[model samples]
Each structure stands twice: as C-alpha cells, then as structure tokens.
Target: MRPGHDFIGVGVGAMVFDDDGRVFLARRGAAARNEAGLWEFPGGMVSFGETLAAAVVREFDEEYGMAVEVGALLGVSDHILPDEGQHWVSPSFAARWIGGTPAIREPGKCTAIGWFRVGALPEQLTQASRDTLTAYRKKGPA
Candidate 1:
C-alpha cells in the first residue's frame, strides 16, 4: 500500500452539548489561514504523532480553555479543498465538558466562542463544519 497516497492529515472536532442540548461553536478569526471569519466546531489538525482522542482533548483545551471527556466517535469526514490546498480526514467525537468556560485560549486561530442550539446554528459556518453538524444532527448525540 502506498503510504502518502492516503496520508491525508487528521483532525478532531468536538460536539460539546450543554445541559440544555446546545452545542459549543467558535468563530474562526479573520487572520486564520483557512475559512477565516466563519463559525466552526472548535478543533484543529492533529499533530503528526498524536492520537485522535488525545488530539480532540488537547484541541478543546487549547482553543476553548476547557477540559473535555471525549466519548464515542461521532464519525469521520474526508474533506478536500484543492482551491485552498487543504486535504484532511477529520474524526469527530461526542464530548462532555469537564471544566472551564469558553475563552479565547488561542487568539491566533479563534476570535469568539459561543453556545448555540444545535437546531439553530450560525449562518456563517464553515462548509466542512456544517456538514459535520448535519451528520451529527441526523445521528443524534452518542
């Protein structure tokens, strides 16, 4: 098997639902490299040697200043954006908040964070993130 042929980078996103079932989301900063100024699930690319679960937890803390107890794997999506020279295979997961509140932990990547009802997401969500949310809605939280 050719290694790099299917070696798309990995990413981890969290569907952090609150007591009332609202989900956490973040608006990408205007200075981000891709999909700037768009709402998206708070996450980032997994490091070269990182596990998907670990990456999810790390990203949650880094981006949102909160610790997450990751649960079931929600699903995976293979997204390719040739226009932006991006290709990633994202493994999303259902997570529960363990501690801390949403804060701008990583100012370079995220500008704002908020909780919204899953049924009523922001209109400016990133396409890939929106697709993930759609799948989550269809499957319901695990």
Candidate 2:
C-alpha cells in the first residue's frame, strides 16, 4: 500500500543554503510522485521510526549528494494534493549545506537542480514548497 494513498504519510525536507545564502531547488520530472514539472525544495518520504531531522538529512544526502547541518523547524505543511490523490504531513527545516556541491542524484525524480535567492524562485512550485517558502519568509532574518 502506498503511504500517501493508503494513509497519511510523513515527508521531510530542508531549505538548504550555501555560503552565498541561495537555497537549492529541484524541478520535478515526469516520474515524480506528484506535481510533476514544478520546482520544490528537494525532499522525500520518511522511513518508519526515522526522526524528522534525520529524514531531512538523509534525503539531502541521497537525493542531492550533499550534507547539511539541520537547523530549526521551518514549519509543518499539509500537502494535500487532492487531484493527485496524495496527502502528506510534512515538516520542513532550515539547513546549511556543509559538504559536497549539490547535484541531481535522482534523475527520475528530478529534471533540474539549481540554487536561487529566495526572492527569485521559479514560478511553478509544489504545494509543500510554497508553504515552506511562506514559513521561511515569516521567520525572517534567518
């Protein structure tokens, strides 16, 4: 049974910034689980018993080939993609890229990857990413 389809799922992500203060983002590809073609703060589903922070770290390592220093929680978002028939309760955090340059480690899940100043993000964004950005803006100066 699919986690988001069969029941509410838990996903985790991080807004990882480089020394230059640009956040990393990835465009979803055709094989993305949902919101294909939209850009998002890269992340993925949480494994059973994994801490949210650990999940965020693991996702960055596995999906972007980068290590991150997890910061405080950015916010929680209900990623209810009704049209796609998926629901996820996601907790996104603030993180700093500590090691390795970012790269698209999961080509099937991501079509493009880049770092951008928060103010100049791409127009099309995934629901969770939009929410994450909102929370980040509200936090301010961090």
Candidate 3:
C-alpha cells in the first residue's frame, strides 16, 4: 500500500547461475519504469494465474533470451519503491541456466547483461536484487 501504486503487486526474481558459478545480471535501461540504471537479476511481475516458478521462467526468457531451470526458493522481499509509487512482494529463486546466451532483448528495459561473481557484482544494484543476492550467498553454493 504505497502511494501511486494501486494493488499490492506480486513479482518473481531468479538468481540464474551458469555452470561456471557466475550469476546473470542486467542493467536496467534509462527507459525502465522503475529503478532505471540499476543492476538487477532479470525478473518481472507475476501475471494473474501464473505460478511463481512459471513467472521466473517466463521472465528469464523475456528479459535475457534464455531459459532457466527454477530451483529452490531463495527468499522473499518487500520491494517498495516509494519514489516510484510501487510496492511489490518479490519471491526470489535460485535457478540453473538451461540455454541461450544472455542478450539485451528489451533495449528499453535493459541496457546490458553480464555474468559476475558474488564478490564482483556491479556497485549500483536494485534493492530487491541486492537483497536476493545476499540471501542466495548466505545459503551458500548448491
């Protein structure tokens, strides 16, 4: 229940890991609706009637041109962008890369995509992404 936002939104995020242990991240484009220019794990709002795992799969495909095998749930976070008038409950999950190279499929939404080690992630990260990464790391490598 934040200002400028309508209903409470449910979202899903995936911490996609490559075989080499690098995690995929994307830089939000300037034209992104919220948290523009911040690095984040590729994800999006969950559509009505969609399962959280399904949302994670669809989000990876839509944002990174890749498919993911959704793994265990990492954690959940309250992503309240008060400045942008958005409130979201985001469930983050661990996933394994299944196919396709990361790409900037949505130029208006993401400016860049890359894989990084936990110790070497970009400085500017979206709050939700930061939270998810921390939770993932605390759980240790699977």
Number of the top TM-score candidate:
2
* Residue runs of model 2 more than 4 Å from their true location after superposition: none
Writing each residue's lDDT as its tens digit, candidate 3 over 17-83 gives: 9999889998999887689999998788888789999999998988778989999999998999888
Each model's lDDT comes to 0.78, 0.91, 0.87
Give the CA lDDT, 0 to 100, for residue 6 in model 1: 44
Sort order, TM-score high to low: 2, 3, 1
Residues 1-142, candidate 2, lDDT per residue (tens digit)? 9999999999888888989999999999999889999999988999998998889889989988899999989899999999999999989889999998778888988999999999999999999999999999999645
lDDT of 1 by residue, 56-129 (tens): 88988877788888888777777676776767777788888878877897787888888898778889987668
Q: Which residue runs of candidate 1 sit more than 4 Å off their true CA positions? A: 1-7
TM-score of 3: 0.93
- Backbone clashes under 3 angstroms, per model: 0, 0, 0
- In model 3, state the lDDT of residue 73: 91
